[model samples]
Each structure stands twice: as C-alpha cells, then as structure tokens.
Target: MADLFVAGGIVTALEDAAVAVGRLDAALAGNPLRRAWTFWSELDAARRHAGADGRKVDLFRLAAHLHGLPLRLGDTASAPERGREIAGLNYAIELRSWMAAPDREQQRLRDIALDSLRDCGGGQPALVATAQGMLEWLAGQGSRPAIRAAVPLYLRDRGITIHRLAAVTGGDSLRAGPVDPDGFTVRFLETVGREAAEGRDLLLTMEREWRQARLRVDHRAGARSNSRLPAAVDLLAASPLLSISALAEALGCSVEGASRMLEALVQLEVAAEVTGRTGRGARRLYGLKRLLPIRAETTAVQRRARGGPRGRPKRVLIAPFAELADDAGVADATPDAEPAEPTRLTAASFDFDALDRLIAAADERTRGVRRLLDRIARGDKPFPTADGTEEPGAA
Candidate 1:
C-alpha cells in the first residue's frame, strides 16, 4: 500500500510537471513577457507561494528573481535607492492600471495588482519568464509540435539563447547530434503539435541551444563575491539614499571603515563619485549609486537569490495537498489516512493586540527619528542620538 501510494505520488508529480511545462511553453511561444507586468506580477506571487508546499523547487524561486530584471538593469536609481525607484515604478504601474481598466468592477482587481506592485518595488521580468518557461516545458502537455512552433517566436521575442534557455529552465537535460533514444524529441514534438520530424530536428536544435544559453547566463550571474563586503550592501543597495555617516551609525562601524568601502564601490563603478559638502565645512563625503545598465547587477542578484535554477526559493510553497489527498482517496481503494501528528499546514488565525502595540511603538520611534533629522537640517544646533547631552553643531 505504501509503495502504491508513493507510486501514485510519482505519477501525480509527473503530471504536475507536464502541466507546468505546457504553461511555460505557451508563455515562451507567445512571449507573454509582453503582457505588461504580468510576468513580474505572477513571478512575485509564485515567489510568495513557492515554498508554500514545504519542499523547495529552484524553478519557482528563479522565476521570482527573473521578474525584477527590467527595472534592475535599466533603471538609473542606486541599489539603495531601489525603494524609491520601486515606489516611482509602482506609481507608474498604478497610473497605467487606472488608465487601462475598462470597467469599475475590474478596477478593484487592478488596484490590488497595483498594491502588489508597490509592495515588491521593482525586479526583472525576463529572467522570471524564462525560468517559468523552462518549468512549463517539463509539464508535457497538448502537442509538442505546436509548442515547437511557438519556441522560435518565443526565443526571438525574448532574445533567449537556446543553450541558456535549456539549462536553467529545468527538465531532463539533452545533448546535440542524432536525437538520443531516451530523449524528449518525440514527446516534445507531440506536445507542440508537429506531426513531421523535419521541424523536430530544428526545434531540438533551438531547444538545446536555448538551454545552454540560459545555463551560461545563470552561471555568470551567480559568481562568488571575492571581496568581504558587508551583507548590509544588499540591504543598503535596496535602500540607497542612506548617507555614509548614517550608514556607519546604523552599522555601528567607524566612519573611516565605511568610507573605505565607499571608495571601493567608486572604483568598481557600482556607485558614482558624488560630491556631498557640509555647508560650514570643506569635508566632502562619498555615496554609492547603481551603475547604468542596471540589468547586469539586478539579474545577478536575482539569480543568486533564487538559488539558481535547481534550488528552491527561501519562502514557503503551499501545494493544495489536502485537496489532492481527498481526491486521491476517491481514485484509489486505500483511503488516505491521517498522519500521526496531523501534518497540519494551515495555522490557526488569531488577533494580536499586544503585537499591534509593539508595532505602534516601533512606528513612533521611526517618526521620532524623522523629526530629529528634520530638526538637524534646520538651524537647530544640537544633534540628537549623541552620548550624554546633545552637542551643538559648529557655527
């Protein structure tokens, strides 16, 4: 019975994979990345729910990272300025939504979509679409020939090389030459709706190359950081407007150490040399901003964060297992028995007034800090957050 259960699970998994692959193949064929924020939006949702199942899958996470590629690579904002950049982009997305929604009823969904966009800030959609494209390839649906017909169109629009496309997109890997016996050729052809084998070879050629290209892109994006840069770089890059002195204070580091890192950044071109001067002093300070063609840095980080194409995202993936189990019971003679501990996935929902109070306190503290900064910018002399008493600034 246990063996049968496991076997049933295997069959179900294969079916799911095939379904996912078909969806991806359709996406690639149509270049659904053209769907105006659809790719990033879905990728964002997938990322949130990828680990909702418990076991991690690399494809979903990769999809999430890939969704942010456009803004990351193309935007002029510093990495730290990502929030502001994202805020601006989100406003634009909302504005577009507001303009495009045809009916008042659809407007609510559009608003929800806009809110989601605001929450995620900005990211790469191409990479996300590619990752998803690969997953859908595995699901083995409809006809492979139809899917094949779509591939060229898909690859052409996305600028996806065949090699890279195959590698990172997940599936049983393939090689060049006469099709291997245990290969995906016939299955792929069948899935895409191609009856003749002439296009079969050509489609396989494209598929193999696309996989290789994706592999190379994924590899280059995930190179190790040789330098000992702080993890704060990632956090700060996400919040770019922070001043060096402010960052030093936040990180509890000496001002000079922070300056040295900034110097390194200037050299690497991750940040441009900006001239910041004290009104009363000649001391020039340094800050970092993301380099142009922001795609390069953002793509790499997205790839890394998704744990490549093989590993899963860090979040939870919630497959509808309960629904599946009940359905499975009807399909098989052996009724699905409950596990020893119940293996509960859904947590009990409850209110937390105390937690709300704590959150309120934190909000108050943030407001206080903002007020203090405002005061400092004014002629108010004394600096707060200092030891002993507030020290007056130089006249």
Candidate 2:
C-alpha cells in the first residue's frame, strides 16, 4: 500500500518539475544577456554545491579569480587552499569547454571512480552495480552538477547532485531524506519548483534591467551614428569584465580606439572602470556601471575648491588713510575741551569681571540642566517643572 502511494506522488512531482524546467529553458533561449545569465547560474550552482560540502565561496572573489585577475592583498593568507577549492568549483561549473567536448573529462572521472571502486573489493556487488549505473546515467545527462556528484572520486564528496537528479527523474529510487522515498521526492520536487520559479523571476528582472540600460546607452549614443558603440555596449553587458585589449579584439578596433570608447562611456556614466586604479598606466578593467561594483571615490571627478583664492589676500594699506583720519579729527575735536585723554581701549580699562561672572553662571546652569536631564533619563528623578522644581503631585 505504501509503495503504491509513493509511486503516485512521484508521478505528480515529475509533471511539476518538467513544467518548471521548461519555463526556465524558454526564458534562456536566444536572450541577449544569455552569456551573462549562464555565468550567474553557474556561479549560483557552484555556491550551492560548495555550501552543501561545508565550504563557503565568495562569489565576487570567485568572479575576479575567473577573470584572471590577481586576488586582492588581504586574501593571500588562505590563497592556496581557497585557490584550489575555487579551481575545483570552477571546473565543476564550467560549461563552455565541457559542452564543446565533454567525453574526455567524463572518461577521466569515470576511470577514477571505477579504480576507487575496484580497490574496495567486490564485496557488495549490488552497491557496485548501482554505482556503475549512476555513472552511466550521469554521462547521459547534460547537468554538470549531477555528473560531478554521481562519481565518488573526491574525499569530501556528498552526493547532492544525484539526490537532485533522483528528484527530477522520479523513477530513480534514491534516499533523499531520513523519512521515506515518497517524502524525499515530494520535498525535493517542491524545492526545485520553487528555485525554478525564483530563477525565472530573476531572469526576467535582469532582462528588463539590461534592456533599459541598453536603451539609455542607445539614447546617449544618439545621431553621431557610431555603430561600434552599441556593439561595444552589448559586449560589455554580456561580459563580467573586460580589458582594453580584449575589448579591442572583440570589437575589431585598435586598442586606442577601444580605450577612447570606454572613456567616453565612463564619462557618460553608463560604464565604469572597476580596477580602482587612477593612473593612466594602470591595468584598467571596465564593466557596465550598473551591473558591477565600482569604487565611487576612485572614479568621481575631483571638485575644485570653492570661494575666493586659496590663501589669505595680501595686506594693503591706503596711502590717504592718515590724511582722511586727520580731517575727521579736526572736524570732531571741540575747541575748549582739554584734549580728552585720547579714549584708549586697553585690556585693563574695560571691565570683564561682570561678564566673567555671567559666563560662569551660564556654565553652571548648563551643567545643572544636563545633570537634571540625565537623572530623568535614568528614572532617578521626576520630570522638572517650569521653575526647575519636580512636577507637583509627582512621585
């Protein structure tokens, strides 16, 4: 009875999985950002698989590593170990060369698995046979993760891919969870369906953003009628990052021309140089400004100092100042008054004693107010009244 129920559930799950995958496939077909989407999908897969194996991979650094750029300084301590793991993940997720010619690598991994199995001695023929069948099934499938996980060649290998495959195939009976095959099938199918739906939504969003960006670029490129500019924008949109030489080669233009084009785009604020370098001679890398992380401080234009000259103005003395003062003195002086002791403003003449007392009183009042506020905040005292006494009828 239980077996019958399990089989029925799997049938339903298979239909859902198929539909989800089909939608994702349709979304990917002939998209202008297909390459970019493929790269993102592979990175996501690598991150998931690595997480399953208890390893954390930084997607940004992985992107940089794949782009052949040197890892930034602080990462050098764990460089070797992290580098090896990244290389493995890269090999696992890489599709271009694999899709071109997969037989060689597949054969190599198969031989490794077989050799390992043989050394263990043919004790459980059923288990060995099952493993062999999995390897063959893996070869027939186009999924890279499934193939990598089906083979037990790595010491830290966890068969996550095979479990996912089992979920998708529905016919392959693999224990996906501790409960039962039926529960595992249902759970995995649900998870895959959800992921596919989410991926499709993300793809749509990326496409929308890409299209808007392209239109903005086109509008900015207006009437000058430069065909290469739009093509270059498309290339940058599809690429993770590109150097001048690479862009030149792709556009079939001179390196200088590519440099000028990138500069123009940067100025237009549609593209940015990502290397965080300012020198003309630095090895600069460029990417779509909206899609990649750009150091704003490095790329922002330096603002010139505002207001007047940079330093104090030179002092100027008026030539007729003494004559003008004498004239004013004659006009204002009284005829009989014993030239009033030229009113002088000396430090000792002015009385600051009263002002000093006022300032001291003010300081004391400020300190008292601060203390009162602190006490109120701490709930040690009641709110004060208009006259600075505790409120009437208050606790």
Candidate 3:
C-alpha cells in the first residue's frame, strides 16, 4: 500500500509538471514567480502540518522537482533523474536569479547536467529514454552546439567568449568543442523572461530602495562640456554593462575618447572594468550594478552616505543573532562561565512595551530609529529584503 501510494504521488507530480510546461506561455506572459512561489509555500505548509514531514521544500528543490518531473517519470525502474533534476533545476534557476552565482554552485550543477546527458546516450528503454534524452538535450542537450546559445543573452552582452567564460561559467575545468547544445536557446529565452520579471519585481518591491539607489547619471552632466559624455551616462543607467566598441557606438565618439569616458565612469564608480587587458588587441567590459542583472541594492545609498552634503551618515548597529540574550538578559553559559540552570524568557515573549521604553530612553537620534521601525511595522514605509520583496512591517 505504501508503494502504491508513493507511485500515485509520482503520477501526480508528473501530471502537474506537464500542466506547467503546457501553460508556460501564459506563465511567461504574466508573472513567472507567482505560481512558482505559491506552489512551494503551500507544499511546505502541508509538509509542516503532516507532523512526521518536517522536511521543508525550498524554491530550488521545488523548481527542480517540477521542471524535471517529466524526465523522472520516464524511468520508474531506475529514476536517478529525481536527484539529477534537482541539479538541473538549480542550475537553471540560479542562472536566472543571480548575475554572479557562486563558483561552486555553477560547477556543481553543470557537472550533474553534463554527466547525466552522457549517461543517457547508451541504449535505454524506449519510453523511458526519450524524456531522459530531452532532459539531457533540453532541446539540444547532448550534442555540442553554439556556446553563445548556452549562455544567457545578458551574459553574451557582457562579451562572453571562450576565455571570458572560463572563470564565470562556474567551474575551473574546461570542456572543448561547442559549449551550447540544442534547445538551449529556447531554455535561455524562458530563463531570460523569468529573469526580466524578477528584476522588475525587485525594483518595484521597495519604494525607498529604488528611490535611494537610482544611479545618478545626472550628477556629472553639468560638469562636462561634451554632450556625448552626458549621453554616455544615460546609456549606463539603461545598460550598465557594455563593451568598449559598444560604448563608442552609443556615445558616437572615437574609441580613444570612449576609453577615456569609460575610465571617467570607473573613477565615478558608476562602472568598473570587468575584464583584464593584455598589452594589445585586448577587449574589455565595464559593468554597473544599477541596471538589469542587478547586483547590490545598497549602491546609491552607500555612495550618498560616503559623499553626501552631510559628512557621513550615522551607522545603526543591530545586535547580531549570536549576541541576542534570553528574556531575562541571560544567555547560555559558555565553557569559561559557571554552569547554571538555563532560564526561559517569559516576559520578553508577549509585549514589547519594555523594549519600547528602553528605546525611548535612548538619545534623540536613537529614539528616531524606533519611530522609523514603528512606521515600517505599520506599513507606512517600504524597506528592501534579501529575496527582492517588501515584508511591510517586518522591521
């Protein structure tokens, strides 16, 4: 009965996956993540309610399970693809989410995808192997194809090449021949669509964050006599990463002047050189975090804090989790301290009236911090979160 139940679960997963892929166009057209996050949040809630099922499903696991479901269902006898799909989905989504995902994550997922593709080449059951092959090829999975197609169009815009990708493609090991495979283009388009939606959502998430962090291209506009330099600044706000030649074309300036302008941007910290150049014939790329493929959210805030009309902005220090004490202002004894019965924090659990009083006793500026937090708590202001959304009153 347990086996049958598990089999039924497998079937349900497969059908859901099929339904998702079939309706992916609509998913692409509307919000890509609305369905994705809702599905996992509900699944996780269900898991928590089921007492024994403490295991939580994160976005990565849920995406992998759903995206690679068709492949897993193809091989009931030897369904290793269940695990493999986790890697594939992780790779796909990470590429979508992060402009610069960690090196280890990139290598780990890429190796899994490559090995899985290679393994499926040998003779396998007809029905089982077809979906697996599609998984491997992912449209053009096993066969070597154009390397550019394998990379996101955004990355290609950054001037990806055989050498440039060596470091950024996730792993140190290099595979010769075509880096991109078939159907990779379609996969990338889907990923790009999702990425675009994510970027916009991130920008709109925090009104304060967006208002504070907008790269001020106009700061240098009046100082420069040349009209092209002002145009160049506008271009950077729209597209933060561009090649030297691309910048030249956009600015309608000579390469030497373009190089100078690019350097000026580097000095402004509005852009930075991303590639190392040799003596001659070296192509370089410059990037800013303000545009698509968004990087740090604190760029504008940090810049203003450093050079604002007011000397330096006051820094707020929140106690780290490690330093947080129990309700009675007591913590577990360390090895150096005498052991005592661990006390529970009772009064600290319910109301924060005492905490409010403590804050009220602080200096005027410090007390202002509480007012800011209270405003945040009441949904009166917007603040940024790590996941690119506003938690309204989470302050």
Candidate 4:
C-alpha cells in the first residue's frame, strides 16, 4: 500500500509539473522581453545556488558588473573573492546556455552522458542513467561542488532539451540529503512545478507593468501623439538599464530629447533613475519603476546631503523692466499676460535643516580645537605660528 501511495503521488506531481511547464512555455512565447527574462532567471538561479553555498551575491551588482558598469563604493567584495564568485556565476549561466544549445550540440552532450553511463555499467532507466553519468563525469573532474550544483541544471536541461518542458531549475528542492533516487525524483518534479509557476507569474507581472507604464505615458501626454513614448517604454522593458545616449540612439532622437522624455516618464512615475548620483559626469541609469527591483544607490535625502542635485539646476531669468511709454504712442499697447511663476534659484537655495545638521556635526571638532588652543596657552604644548615656528612665549 505504501508503494502504491508513493506511485500515486508521483503521478499527481508529474501532472502538476506538466501544467506549470505548459503555462511557463506559453508565457515565453512571443514575449518581447524574452532575452531579458531568461537572463534574469538565470541570474536568480545562480544567486539561489550561491546562497546555498553560504555566499551572498547582490543581484543588482552582478547585473551591473555583467553589463560592464562601474561598481559603486558600497560593493566592498575583495578582488579575489569577487572574481571567484563571478566565475562560479558565469559557469552556472553557461550551464543554462548549454542546455539551450542547438540540436546538434545537445545531441553531443547526450551522447557523452550516455557513453559515460555505459562505461559505468548502467542498468538504470535512461533519464536516471544520464543524470548519474553526468555526476560521475563531474566527480572524475574533481568537482564535488559542481556535482551538487549541477543536479538542478541537469534536471532543468533534461526537461528543456528532451521532455519539451519549460526551463526551470530545481535548486529550491535539491537540499542536502542522503542520496535516494525515488525521493530525489519526487522533489525534483515538485520543484519544477513550483518554479515554472513562479516564472509564469513573473512574466505576467512584467507584462502588466509594461502595459500600465504605456497607459500612464499616454495619459500624461493627452492628444499630443508622442509616438516615441511607447517605444521608450518597450526599450526600457527589454534592457536592464539605459542611459540617455543609449536611449537616444535606440529612439533615433537627440540626447536632450531623450533626457526630456525620461524626465517626463519619471514625473509620471513610470520610470525611475537607478543611479544615485546626479553630479557632473555621473553615469545615470534608468529603468521601469515597477519591473526593476533596483533602487537608486542613494535616496533623495542622501543625494541632497551629498550636495548632488537631483537633476539639472533650474534656470533663473531676470525679469525685464517695464518699458517707458513713447510720446507718440510708439510703445506696444498689447496687454501683458499674468506674470509667470518665479523660477527658484537652484544653486543658492538654502536648506536650513541641513545647515543645522552640519553645524551640529562640527561642534565636536570645534571643542577639540578649543581644548588644543587652551593647552597651548598654558604651555602644555607648543603652539605653531603662521610661519610654522613655535611661538616665542610657548614652551
């Protein structure tokens, strides 16, 4: 009876896994951001597996590093440690790539797996034999860690390349445990179902966000026919990050125009600048606010404290003087419109709260300076003069 119940559970699990895989595959079909989605999914898998091995890899930094962006000061990982982690992540990503390779390459990999299994005196089923052989080959390469890490990759690859299921990693289920083929198969199928469902949900959320962003952009520019806005939205969705120049090139527009469009999206709350810095020459990056998990490296308050303006300073204009009426009615008689709102000075604007904080911070240093001066006055220490010589009356 126990054996029969286990068999029933396996059947149920397999059905659920098939349903989830179908849903995920449907979502990926014709997805405009499919490449971006796959890249993020692979990165997420790498993150999870790295975490299992007691390493915390920041997804945002890894993405930025992969894209050749400059790392912020907060990324304090030592060079060797960062390199090792990145190499592992690259290998994990490569495994996914291999799983998605062309039919010929996949055939080659399958042949290798089968040959290894035959050499190991295979009597298991085909799928189980292939997986065991893959592990055995990895072990022969002296990669115990890879043997463990590759379990999910091998299962995902088998599903994608052989079973025509969605590419879904099983890391969430393949925890450390005694090796039991039946138990492992149950867990692996269960994880595939769960991960496929999650991937489908994520894709749905991204699509929803994309549509909402487009609607917001259209609503903000009512009746103006801003054709580039939707394109911008699509571009932002497909790329992890974009700079003004990149956007301009993509949209076939001027840099200033692209900047203006980005600001408009930001104003409409559709997009967000992920880069924390706004100083001159700072590399600014922007992305869809809802789709991306990355936030600005610094917040608005933090940027203000750092004396970096959030954007270009507002231009101040000098009000023109009222012209004196000419004797012969030569002055224009058109009525002037209501005076426009005054443009505030960006550079000279004062923040009294920040000023107070600065003064408070300086108090300790001020007291220390005063104590040193008092000690010099009492000859407890020699006082240096402006000429870098000790005062004559000092000790």
Top candidate on lDDT is 4
If scored against the real structure, what TM-score would every candidate get?
A: 0.21, 0.52, 0.27, 0.57
In model 2, the runs with Cα more than 4 Å from the true position are 1-6, 73-103, 107-176, 278-281, 294-395
Query: Which parts of model 3 are misplaced by more than 4 Å?
Result: 1-214, 222-241, 276-283, 289-395
lDDT of 4 by residue, 1-395 (tens): 12212355466767777677766776676556555565466656655656655565666655554433444433676888756765654444333333333134444554555345456433533234333454456446633233333443444454533223323655555466536656665676677688777666566656656667766876766797656776677777656567776777666789889888887887687887765456645556788874233443232222332455675322223211112222354344445542222222122222233323323332333334334444655887545567755563331
Deviation in angstroms for 380 in model 4? 54
Which digits, one per residue and each the tens of the lDDT, describe model 1 over residues 143-200?
Answer: 2222222332343344533211221121112212234322343233232222112122
Which residue runs of candidate 1 sit more than 4 Å off their true CA positions? 1-90, 93-228, 232-246, 254-257, 269-290, 293-395
Q: 1-395 in candidate 2: lDDT tens per residue? A: 12222256466765665467556656665455545555455545455555544555555554554443445434455768855765554543342222112345555654555444344423322222323344344345534344433332221123222212211221123323434434654555555565555556555655554455556767876886755676666666665566776677766689899999887777766676765554565557787764343322122222222563543222233210112221366557676553221221122312233223323432343344334444755887455666766663321
On residues 146-224, what C-alpha lDDT tens digit does candidate 3 reach at each position?
A: 1211332213232321111111121111112234432332232333333333322332222222122223444566665
lDDT of 4: 0.53
User: Could you tell me the lDDT of residue 309 within candidate 1?
Assistant: 56
Q: Look at candidate 4 and give me any clashing residue pairs.
A: none
Worst 10 residues of 2 by lDDT: 162-171
TM-score of 4: 0.57
